[model samples]
Target: MMGRLARQGGLAVGERIRFDGQVRLVLAVTGRAVILSELTSEPRLVPPAALFADGDFEIVDISGRMPLPPLSLLETLPQPVLEKALWWEGHILEILHGQAPDAPQGAEVRPEYAPTRSLTARERAKAGW
Candidate 1:
């Protein structure tokens, strides 16, 4: 049974699992796969490939399907999950741009030298003749 398989794998529906570097709420469990919805304002299905058979996810908490609320309850979630989401978003942007996560922003630099030119002949003559 799917439930038995899930237990054997130490995973269950309604448990928070991470996939694709983002935290997700498990919606269903099966012998082969799990259905997950990312923790966000607008949740979406995570592709099957993203799930790790090795159980790489950090289990945030255990709340089965019945207790899990709909989109309306996202605001009440714990602070760590929200912070992880923010970090994940920034990570994705960095990956796309090939940038370091902590890279500094460029600053405007002032040039060291002032403009210079030869003095006019009249000005030169005033100094000596």
Candidate 2:
């Protein structure tokens, strides 16, 4: 039944399907009628037969799940820093929060700025000794 369904294009891309207690998303279908791009921790392409057997398969369209931006280290940054550092961050925040940058848009971000440090000759001498 799974093979027949796969061959007949019953599965849609980004559609969530379950086989043998594993949940996967169909990413694409090929000329060989194979369900390609099964979602796991990582995507794995395999024959539909290996996925579905004993007439036990379930498919659910989860395309409506809110789209998440690709994960990155930037997610940890303060909102102000993110907005100031990257243009895309501002856009992402706008889409997610439904608002614009609150910290005065178009403000210049200076990456080269650094606080000055005062060094004492006594401290340098103590280190040398």
Candidate 3:
């Protein structure tokens, strides 16, 4: 079901879709609506569900992930910098996932309630959040 939904209506900005009798480009996707336009007409925000419900609908091309900018990097960073970047990514994932990343195998420890460590600044901040 998710795959079908994506194929039919999960359009991204700059994606070209063969809609109606001509090709239209997705200008933007906001909330439940998709803004689309062709060279001959002004853009219109239409519900994706309704836009793809009927008529000729096909994804012609996807420019959603234009990579020309990233491809310009000619050299990798220093090893230490790369390691720090990776560590930063882990921190971002921890926040996004609402928990710290798991320990490596054999490093897991049982949960313990340390009364002495209670109400610390970090714990207080977490509770406030």
Which numbered prediction scores highest in lDDT against the true structure?
A: 3
lDDT of each: 0.45, 0.46, 0.53
Better of 2 and 3 by lDDT: 3
Q: What lDDT tens digits, residue by residue, belong to model 2 across residues 6-85?
A: 53223444567776567666764433343545444556665655555525477755442224456487778898877576
Give the alpha carbon lDDT tens digit for every residue of 14-124 in model 3.
678877777887775655687888576688778867777746777888543322234123238777776686676554333222234444433422222111222232244
TM-score of predicted structure 1: 0.33
- Model 1, backbone clash pairs (residues 3+ apart or across chains), number: 0
Report the C-alpha lDDT of model 1 over 13-48, residue by residue, as the tens digit: 457766667777776544445667755565554444
* Candidate 2 lDDT for residue 50: 56
Off by over 4 Å in 3: 1-5, 67-129
- Judged by lDDT against the true structure, how good is candidate 1? 0.45
**Model 2, which residues run further than 4 Å from truth?**
1-9, 33-41, 52-54, 62-129
Greater lDDT among 1 and 2 belongs to 2
**Least accurate stretch of 10 residues (summed lDDT) in model 3?**
109-118
